[model samples]
Target: MRALYQIAFLACILFSCGCSDSNPSPSDDDNVPPPSGTSSFDIITQELSNDLTIDIYVPRVENASGKYPIIYFNDGDVFKGAIASLTSYKFEASSGIEPFIMVGISAAGHRYGRYIPYNDQWIKENWSDYSPGSINYTQRLINEVIPKVEEDYPVDTKRRAIFGFSLSGLYAAWAGINYPEVFSFSASMSPSFWVADYAIFDEPRELSNTRFYFDIGTKEWNYYVPMIESLENLGFRYGKDIFYYEVPGGIHAESDWASRLHIPLGLFLNGTPEEVEGYEIIKECIPSQSTAGLVFQRLNPIVTFTNGIRYSLSTSASFQVVSGDGVVLEDGRFDTKGGSMTVEVSHGNWSEHISLNNCNN
Candidate 1:
């Protein structure tokens, strides 16, 4: 999928230092032309003696600029290439929706060790046998890689963020809390909160300037609910700047994360990215209309309710919606989703397919 990001609530990023007359800055996520003179670069830092490596994607907009805003994705290299794939990268890069220097660190070998917070208790419990080079790996990211990126490239140190999925998501949050000076914004996708029960929020230091984005699927697990709720209940607002999304059925993997990437980049980096303006729930699948073949060609399958509100029933065949009239309906929603303009429906012993290609709202 092709995607771009926006620069929302960027009071912190403006100070990152890339906007200088001597050196211009990169374009915003919109892919607008750089304001002339912006330059970017990539650099590898092996100075920390930690056997660490990093791949930096500079915006090329930070020319001669002292510092450019940064967005670092932990295990980004892994999340991009094979595990998650980089078409997402090509999409963002080419589309210019939300553009910034993307730095991807190779966590190919030691993901578990570096992503998890390592303390005495954690070491003994979740990481019964600690991953040998994990903490050091994170240290490499924090101390070795970041500083080198700053030194080697013309980037604004102040305007920066870290993000990733699963363990990497966990690490991105940890880095923001541990070294707020280095990164001011953070996002975590489907984090593994149970790793040590609120250990993340209980970091040793509090970053007065840090803004965060945390998301989890409603059906993921019990831990996510409490973890996110606790953060909200506590005085941890991070205020209007913090972005939170509760995906109804998000899972734990790159595919799941990829599908939802737009949320974080929209809400956090760009503030409610979807164009909900001219858009409304065009089709609230009547729960009664649900059936076995309840899917429209490419749209998200949904089961409409009597009130006209539609919701996804189940992608698999194990579930269906029962209408008030006692009619078992296949659940799903429809829209100008694909070229087919058709919906499949099915229910116990009954089946019907409907054509919604004419739906236009």
Candidate 2:
């Protein structure tokens, strides 16, 4: 079943991209020469400990001169290759992604040693080989890494961001809240939020101007789902820049992270304040756990709804439009119950495998 889904996805993606002109008509300034984006490296905090390599990607515009926002990425070595395509795509397409100075800080060879926060239970158990150095790492980034980058490049101090994946992703959240003065935007894609026994959730900290983006694959770990929910319950207002997303079939891998990187970047750079408002999910029938051979419709605003004549005979079957928090915003029994409903949604995207099963029984 997953294979068929992939096949359909690839077909859709290819068809969409293939149908569009590779080079759409350019804008007025399109003729201008592109910036001389440079990639370079430096060793940070040489005095205290092992030197950490920071790979910086600087985007230059030909005639423009001003400070640009900074996005510091964990796992710098991996993005050394991934950054080019991203910058190039921004230049080639009209996507709202902005070009910022991206600094990739390399994770230590012993990732668990540095990424893991100090915890007695974890240290005494499976992570005995490593000691937590998250504080030291965060210190180096604010004191050494940012200062070093700022020394040679123009940076927008007001709009700095830090992001990461997996273990380092956990670090992004810890550092963003703990040190809000240094980072305003923080994103953790598929973060190992369960680490240290959910220690981040144990204590509350004062947050000011701190925005967080947390996302993970639904297929990854069912237990991890509530970790994000706890963030919402802890007073991170959704429209106020704290957002959470779930990729239906996402996984813990670089490819999946790369594909969704634009979502966070877009939200930070050019997000529309009203995009999520009035968004609705309309479902005709909730599929059974063992249901199969069903047609799953992708969630969209323009989806046409039929009366579902085949299942209308059953009086007990129902329909619902639930919010992300599981609140039944709108619901009713099918047409057999003499109920009427109309839904209007806009500017939100969700992927759910909807199926109709045993409704006629």
Best by TM-score: 2
- Candidate 1: tens digits of C-alpha lDDT, residues 224-274: 323333444544542244554545555444555655565445444443232
- In model 2, residue pairs whose N, Cα or C atoms come closer than 3 Å (at least 3 residues apart or on different chains), thus clashing, are none
Question: Among these predicted structures, which one has the highest lDDT?
Answer: 2
> Candidate 2 residues 33-140, lDDT tens each?
323453222223222246587767666442133777788887664434333334554432344444577787766464565566756454344334566788887888
| TM-score for each candidate, following the candidate numbering | 0.54, 0.63
Question: Distance (Å) between predicted and true CA of 184, model 1?
Answer: 0.6
Q: How many clashing pairs in candidate 1?
A: 44
